[model samples]
Target: MNYTAEAPAVWDPAFADADDCLLSSDQCVIHGEHCFVKGLIEIPVIGSDEVFSWGVWVSLSRENFSRAADLWNRPGREDERPYFGWLTTDLPVYSPTTLNLKTNVHTRPVGERPYVELEPTDHPLAVEQRTGITPARVREIAAAVLHPGSGGHR
Candidate 1:
């Protein structure tokens, strides 16, 4: 998924105008929209390693969200399956900016407050180390990446 481009000429405004940055704390996808389950974006497989820097996005559908939440909370569920989480081979490389990893997790047990249990393979810690990105930041970036005509290239 590595897509290289010549260093920008005049700071291509298209990059700025691109519509990424879409996720919110409450809403995954806007109502009545066609959500997607895109691929995970990883960082340099070589070089310095870091942890807890990856994020996950899945087109923001109620169905996928519920499914992921269930798996995180309930590992014993029969429908549980592995999800994808990766690093960006390209981007608007900046901290505190959106552009994140994407994956799914299961819901936590009832009466134990609210939480999700992500599988170890898809763990944010491992993904971040591989990608050198933060989990929360990844989500923010993912929202932007998924935005229409944003040159997301993740």
Candidate 2:
């Protein structure tokens, strides 16, 4: 399941107008009226290397974006890592169907920007990674901090 190549290049201007764009401290870009943001995720596979999925983009409301930004920059927040948010976006290269997933956004020192880790939850993919992951049925959990609802799923 390992990525055959490096991650895809970041598309700077997701929207036509650069003036309305805002990049969060964690590197999520918000632009146009939809508050669009893009990031990547790693999906675990049993008895195999993890798969890296890129071009994972979602659209959030202005208020939700603001809330996420606040949590991203909140002081004394080092104790609380991996902010969670409900972002709906299709995994272009994988599943073309849009998924309403709870994503964990965190920064990894190895990369230039942050990585958005997907919480398996009850998704079918979780079952596939059972043996490859820890403690039988136990799933990797993150703090349920950001609860930005699905503004748009498609």
Number of the top lDDT candidate: 2
lDDT of 2 at 22: 56
Clashes of 1: 38
Instruction: Give the per-residue lDDT digits (tens) of candidate 2, residues 1-61.
Output: 2221121123354443577655442334534445534555544544445442444544445
The window of 10 residues in a row where model 2 has the poorest summed lDDT is: 137-146
Error of 2 at 98 (Å): 3.7
Candidate 2 backbone collisions, by pair: none
Please report how far candidate 1 places residue 137 from its true position, in Å.
17
RMSD per prediction, one decimal? 12.5, 10.9
User: Model 2 compared with the native: what TM-score?
Assistant: 0.44
> Which ranges of candidate 1 are over 4 A from the true structure?
1-27, 32-56, 60-62, 76-79, 83-90, 94-154
Top candidate, metric TM-score: 2
Instruction: Estimate the TM-score of every prediction.
Output: 0.29, 0.44
